[model samples]
Target: MVLDAIYRGELLPCENNMEGNGRHKQAGKEIEQLLKDLRNNLSEEDMALVDQMLEQTLIICDTECSDAFQYGFSAGLLLMQEVQEILRKRVDTAAHGVF
Candidate 1:
């Protein structure tokens, strides 16, 4: 999946149209490992945040934009902010304990 994301230029060091084979396979393997580590270490709240972010991203990506591209970007930014808020709330709750 990470290899596909890299090949599609979704991941950083975005080499456009780079075929994922041979040496590039190593990079893909590394990315997969990193992702696994992230998943393993993530708290439940963090995982929830990731899930929300992905859901919003998918919704935005699927919708057709009649307005300028900036509108879509703005909407995505707002969704990201909401995800941040969720993370913040989780942190605050963890610190204070549930009332």
Candidate 2:
């Protein structure tokens, strides 16, 4: 089932529709207000530089989030494999009357 979903392009980790926590939402609002305030005070050139920095920061954040998701998914798969193997061994032992 999971493989079929992946094959159909349905498993998107980074494209979630969930909202961030309250603290993160508040921080984002504060950042937006700060940017607006800065826009009124800073020169156009400086604002452009700030925008470039923000863009770069966003890129870095996206890369980090993607890498983290990949790592978590790999870890989950390994855990599932381990659980299945343990269960299989238990079943085999029980069948052999080894308790």
Candidate 3:
């Protein structure tokens, strides 16, 4: 079943077709920006963030991935929920020159 899921995902035409592929590229760019913001503090690269999140989320979800792998998707996604909020707050604060 896991193999089937992985296989099915491989065949998704979104790569050659564009039913929903565009969303991911946009999301990727956002993640790239966030990771860039983060890399200012850490030493990791943007691609490294994706690689780490994929590996971590797979371990975290431990689901029966299929063409619709339900492993809930990302380590950073979970982290980002919180981090994004914090960053926003920091930005709001910094805008006022409060540091």
Tens-digit per-residue lDDT, 40-60, candidate 3: 766557657766987898676
CA lDDT, candidate 2, residue 89:
100
The local distance difference test score of each candidate is 0.74, 0.91, 0.68
| Poorest 10 consecutive residues by lDDT, candidate 2 | 12-21
- Segments in model 2 whose C-alpha atoms lie over 4 Å from true places: 1-12, 15-20
Specify the poorest-scoring 10-residue window by lDDT in model 1: 12-21
The TM-scores of all predictions, comma-separated, are 0.32, 0.84, 0.33
- TM-score ranking from best to worst? 2, 3, 1
Clashing pairs for model 2 are none
> Candidate 1: which pairs clash?
none
Error of 1 at 63 (Å): 18
Better model by lDDT, 2 or 3? 2
**Over the stretch 1-99, how does candidate 1's per-residue lDDT look in tens digits?**
988986997864324435656687897798678768878999989977877986897577546332445686689899999999999999999899873
Determine the backbone clash count of candidate 3. Answer: 1
